[model samples]
Target: MQPHVTTALQAWIASWTAHERAAQDVMEAAFPGLKPTPAPTGCCDVQMRWERDGEGSGTACLDDHGRATIQFEDVPKAAVGHAMTEVFGNGWFNEGPDGFAGAPPGKYCWEDDCTYAECEIDIGDDGLAAVAISYVKIEDVVAILDALETGLEAVRPSA
Candidate 1:
């Protein structure tokens, strides 16, 4: 069976529940091909949070200007950031409710537009693997997705 959107969503939520070692495990568990390295200090930071039907996770790096530039990578380690972020990187990575709470500590609110949510997973040379989900309620789409573009933006990393 194909991987479900909720499954991916849950996997993202579940990653924060685990300890450091366990976070590595959760990372490995979420992506079969992931290769994680110790996150260098000042290089990367993580944020995780979860809620009922609406939940999300993201990572934001500190820019040269000391500003936080939020970006989404396919793998937790972002080993293939060039590829993954390119396919799925149009989000603000908010600060409340599973938005971005530093090392992705616990519980968060999911922000994304509902009705029709979409994100493309990059699979290297095979092109992009698409993940699109439709909802009966428009609020589900709005509240969950928050009208975030699933496309990669050129200003920074992938879309």
Candidate 2:
């Protein structure tokens, strides 16, 4: 590659690294037991693995765009609704005759043009819930972590 191209590539990688480090630092502070996990090859996201003794384990990733996704495995089915409500707010789940009808499990933006932050939640059959929250500002990372922590608390049994 040309010298200029190489320099640009290096800068791009550096930006991703910086963002990842910042996000990781925040996570580590919030969850002291969090350990670094290998990110997917060629992916721009930073991944971390965390465990709550006798509770459960989860993985968190921060993408280049500062979007953080936390996936909790083996969560209680009963807690899923409360977790969703905690993160997405009340009325996020639609009511139906049979029971609550969940919103589609995929990405969506708060605004029509998507200029604002994006969010998504996917609940799997095996009781794994992956929640993705995007941030328009770096400081919002704290809020994202708080929301995830709150949801996790709802999922875990009380000490």
Candidate 3:
């Protein structure tokens, strides 16, 4: 690579590193014990893994521009609708057979008038539901996290 290109790349990496550190600090303060790490994909700056003893596991990612996407796996299938309603509110629609336009059966999504965020809930063939909270601000990570936990708890078996 050219000298100037290398310098620019280094600067970008440094900025990204600093951003990740700041994001991790925010996440740690909000959700203790869940450490933030580099996301498996290049699209995101960092990812935090979450798990509840008997509930399920999930990952939350944040990008440099403060966009966040969270996914929860292995949740109760019945919770799919409840979660979608709780997190994204009413007026969800199916994306159709090809999983386009909206979301197909066993899946629900809220995409209209989402200036801040949008969310979806999908139940796989394995009988487990997955929740996706997208376009959320990283600064509101705590709020989204709380919403997700509450949505899952709404249908999870009581202890």
lDDT of each: 0.30, 0.56, 0.63
Residue 81 lDDT in candidate 3: 46
Candidate 2, 55: how far from true, in Å? 2.9
| TM-scores for every predicted model | 0.22, 0.54, 0.58
| Model 1 CA deviation exceeding 4 Å by range | 1-18, 39-42, 45-159
**Range of the 10 consecutive residues with the lowest summed lDDT in candidate 3:** 96-105
Task: Pick the winner on TM-score between candidates 2 and 3.
Answer: 3
Sort all candidates by lDDT, best to worst.
3, 2, 1
Q: What does the lDDT read for residue 62 in candidate 2?
A: 71
Off by over 4 Å in 2: 39-45, 64-66, 76-86, 95-142, 150-159
Summed over model 3, clashes come to: 3
Q: Which candidate is the best by lDDT?
A: 3
For residue 126, give model 3's deviation from the true position in Å: 6.2
Which candidate gets the maximum TM-score versus the true structure? Answer: 3
Q: How close is candidate 3 to the true structure, as a TM-score?
A: 0.58
Better of 1 and 2 by lDDT: 2
